[model samples]
Target: MKAPRVAVIGGGLGGLSAAALLARGGCAVTLFERSKHLGGRGQTSDVEGFRFNLGAHALYQGGAGMRVLGELGVKPAGGMPGAGSYLLSGGRLHTMPRGLVSLLTTDALGLPGKLELAKLLAGLGRVDLAPLANITTRDWVEQHLSNADARAFILALVRVMTYCADVDAMSAQSAVAQLQAKPAVLYVDGGWSTLVSELETRARDAGTRLELSARVSAVLLADTGARVRGVRLADGTEHAADAVVVAGGPGDIAALLPADALLAHDAARAVPVMAATLELGLSRLPRPDALFALGTDGPWYASVHSAVAKLAPEGGAMVHVMQYLGGRGPEASEARLEEVMDALQPGWRTSVVARRYRPSLLVSHWLPTAETGGLRGRPSVEVPHVPGLYRVGDWVGPEGLLAEASFASAESVARALVPGQQVASRRAVGR
Candidate 1:
């Protein structure tokens, strides 16, 4: 018997991971993507001297995240700076406060401020967050952070990095995840795109039909109650499948599914995020030992991943600085990016070589629920809403960091195919 035919939409990490797993399990999987590329937001690009990371600035693979990769036999390399971060506070670049002793001794914060931070950090795990889940990050910080100095110096540093979020609208659960657990900032080695490429390659090699440039518009159901029939693409091509995982965006899925079924889904609320990447001449660099820091002044927020010694040519180095903009993104993000570039490195006219960016591509995506269960009553990734149609993505809900969540959600969707389906048939072929 032929394996069940599964249609995996969106070529991003999650979709690719699901397709790979299903194909390997003996299901004939076809992966579709609307973009010309496969990585979705998980992508990379090259300019004059800099290589830009599209999305997912970092990943936390300390526990469950790491376990998921192990289950998929995926290994990753470090993507962020290793030593740590330097902060631009009060017009000066200071070393980041690490331990309790360091926090207390730092002149940036007052003695009382340090004490407050001490109390806060000590109670990190015990803090009641549910009441604060719907509140914004700014509100959370102002309410709980008692020390002004710590608020400005330490918390603000995190704020700039969007620990709370660019708009400060992120839930306490979202921000608390960073402060509570592993507390380590990291990136995939060789950039995040490497991981996406790995998943795509592995899945395609495993008998999966990876389809790019395909757009899925809706899932059509038959007369049978709760029975999912197949999906209809935007271009009018219909692909039949035993089970479908709506792993795109929750808001989008909610809009596509019948209103009756959508009652169970919370309308995905996503904030905006805009970023900029600049490629410059290595000669303009201040040297490797010069610590990377972000100024509170205009648009620049985060900076790292400059392997001056490795990628720079002769005496010139390349660096990519990312600035996240919130609210009314597209135009505002581009405008701020331009403003930040001109302000941060005013010497660009003389010291820089070339810079490239897509101003209009700026996207404001939805945030994931604090936990998988945070959705409370949302449908399962394996369980279809209108019977045969399922859902996936951060909007639907992310496992954690988007990349990992995408993979997890997609896999869950793939495994949901019913018994005797092609997927089941293939799995039982040799057994």
Candidate 2:
């Protein structure tokens, strides 16, 4: 019998990981990317000694992305500064309370509020989130806490963790799970594109054929729609395969299929929570010692990326500021982010060397809605009622969020394609 031939659409992380694993398992894999380059939203651009990524991308120390990279023997380099993060509160920057000492000493919260917060954090790990799965984070906080300061503080933490500003729509269960996990984030020495580059190399090394600038017009299906035969290119070329995998969001996948294609409704209706990001490469450090910080009153986060990674040139600084727009447009959200930046880094705008603004990417992809079982109710990698067809992206269900969900879907697809084969050396989560 001949080895199974697979055709992967989209050259993002999920596609690359799946292609590499399948090819390594003795299958013939051909990865197609419509863009001239791979890495989708993870791509980076370099200009005049400065590097700007698609958005603010960070890898959690024990995240799915790192674990997957570790399986491939790729070690990312960087470290968080010892000063840790800070929060903007009451017209001042206060150190983020981590332990008993900081919680008691930090002026961000009142002593009573701090004590209450400590209890909440301590109980988050052991709390059964099942009962709270259907409630919003806002409701949960209001129900459990009496202090206004404590409520606002926890709301900010939830926004920062879930990347969703609408606390009323955010799932309490998801927030608790993430806060409990407490994943350590890292900035790669160069940029996230560096990791993408490594994944591309690994795929090619595993005998996966990657073709750039090849636009897939549509997935070719069998007579009964039971299996995907291959794909037809935009330029009228046809490539055959035993199976097909789409490494793109639901919206992207919908565009490639027929108007009445199966699962088109789900793809179209799957609403994604978006983010607005402002990245500045400065001539000097703005917040020189801080690694990360959050706004206590709103949905904003800032990080001195260069403090943790060598992202800036000598004597230069790299800062990434992001705003989670609950329902705001780019212009409005960008303005708000600028305000946060101005508040946090006074006189810092004068030192800017280069800046980029990205306002439209699915930060959390699907909204963590308790009403919808959070991510647990998301669509599966396999297209419903279709065989030999799979979808791999953040939108795919695998009990995770963001990049972690992407990695999980990729691994799941690879395992389904190559039964009994160990595609990953160890399991890891992505951010």
Q: Which candidate is the best by lDDT?
A: 2
What's the CA error at residue 348 for candidate 1, in Å? 6.6
Q: Which predicted model would earn the best TM-score?
A: 2
lDDT at 225, model 2? 64
How big is the positional error of residue 350 in model 2, measured in Å on the Cα after superposition?
2.0
lDDT of 2 by residue, 165-272 (tens): 776776777777678777777778788788789999999999999999999988888887667788999999999989899998777777766654667777665768
* Alpha-carbon RMSD of each model: 6.2, 2.6
Model 2 steric clash pairs: 63-429, 63-430, 64-428, 64-429, 64-430, 65-429, 65-430
Q: Write the per-residue lDDT of candidate 1 for residues 1-431, one digit (tens) a residue.
A: 87777777777767777777777777878877878888777786655544456633565545334544555678876644544355554445555566777776666667887787788778878766455446655566788776666565544554443422353445555556555654355655555577688887788788887677777887767766767677788899888887666556655665556455443345543443445544343456543454355544333444435541233344554555555455322333544554443433444455555455544334334542333323222345655346666666643333443444555555556556633223211110001
Q: For each candidate, give its TM-score against the true structure.
A: 0.78, 0.93
Candidate 2's C-alpha runs over 4 A off are 81-84, 259-262, 327-331, 423-431
